[model samples]
Target: MRILVILRQVYEQKSIQWSYEDRKLIYQRNSYNKSDLHALQWTREYKLKADALVDVLILKKEEEASEENKLANFGIQRCFRIPSNGSEKEDAAFISDLLKNESYSLILSGYETEDEHSCALLPLLSYELGIGVLTAVYQLEGKPNGQLTALRKEERGSLQEFTIQLPAAVSVTSHISKLRYHRGRSAPDFTMIEVKRQLSKPEAVRRIEAPEPNIWYADTPSEEIPQLRLLNIMGFASQSNNSNNLQKQTDHLSKAHLYFTAERLVKWLKE
Candidate 1:
């Protein structure tokens, strides 16, 4: 069975900040961070399990071609590169065309990509390919007749296994396997290809910038009114302050407090 594994090089968490303005995604580099751990681990898992052969595909920005190829010496003997168009939707279309042209039994992808394009592609691939998508698969066992069994995390803190039919797409989590130091026999053959983006490029979700109409902020010190502070809701006040005569009686009554009130009502009724 042939497997097509989709991978990507990612900036470490908090390495880049994303902002949007006028249909553009504004990228602000905070620091040079590493790739996503989950993405790396997923790639490493296939390196060990892929017995017959595995084809890897990496979606990377043009500028990051060098940095993203750090995995070349690893399990990837060669990879099909899909130049990113900065649009997840457009990227998925190119990927779908590639998968459809090729005959692959199963398609694998990381649960989340560097910029979360996998969020758009994973499901889109399943729909476009007319297959089922089992996400977060950590372990898998394939059976004859195009049936495969996969293990994934359950919502209740347990592992759940699924039997998915073949011709399926999956988005896997890091729990699948641990990353290794072993590299493939040779440097991976990397091929870059151009994609003609057909869809409108993915626009930034929403832009954040200096306010033209207004700016909404919470707890701004510049505002004249000090923010209200909540305190002592848990009855943390001084014991002396709570030690009034009525308070003392209420505490002493305990279970008898309701009985005292009932008796007073009965007395008033009789009168």
Candidate 2:
């Protein structure tokens, strides 16, 4: 199975210890927390199941060697580093283009990165990809006949067993699977594709690394607190849909009471 794992890096809480020298963004880049273990968990699971060639997608303003090093160390041979401003549309577009010519049996995503960026992207990704998604999924394996098998966490911590066909995405919580530290693994060569550079002519394949920091910094505005929403699933009847049942987040439930449709669900997800 060709698997694409999505990951992100953020400043470690209480670990961002650095002072700016003459307005340069010179904070310790290594201050990001250990979110790599989450990606490692997915890699281990999929590799054990099907020796899957795991690709990775990272949302960032630009590619840096430090970040690529993080993804490439985890047995990943490819990465889609999409430029993002944390909007749902940009997230959809980047993923859509990546899927335009290629398809994968499994797409793994970490539920919440160090800064909870991916948590907001989880539902939006499923709606935009228009594929069967099982959130908080694990114990995933492939059957002999090209079918996928997995488990989900339902309400009250009940484990729900389900199966979906090939070409499905699963959002995994960071702590669900145990992680092991890997060493002596030579850095895997990964092809890096930038979202903005897709339309331009292909550049020569060269080493991926970060350029030296500029003298000044471009400050990104702070993210505003997201407003609460309620979704109603009054008549959610599946049409023999052999799809992976996705679990819901606890606090976002709005106790809405209305008919269910994919359009409405997607609209609500974007909002």
Angstrom error at residue 54, model 1: 0.8
Instruction: Please estimate how well model 1 matches the true structure, expressed as its whole-model Cα lDDT.
Output: 0.60
**TM-score for each candidate, following the candidate numbering:** 0.61, 0.58
Best by TM-score: 1
Tens digit of per-residue lDDT, candidate 1, span 54-126 = 5667766555634433555444444676656566666676788876678777777777654443466777878
lDDT of 2 by residue, 1-271 (tens): 7877766555554544334344322443432224445645767665766667877777653443455554445666677766555454456666776677777777777656564344655556667778787777646556888886777767555678888886877776655567665555455477877556333322345343334576855443232422211111222323232342555334554445233345568888777
Q: What's model 2's lDDT at 129? A: 74
Candidate 2 regions off by >4 Å? 14-40, 63-65, 184-186, 197-271
In candidate 1, which residue ranges exceed 4 Å CA deviation?
17-50, 73-77, 114-118, 144-146, 182-186, 189-200, 203-205, 208-271
Model 1 residue pairs with clashes = none
User: Which one is best on lDDT?
Assistant: 1
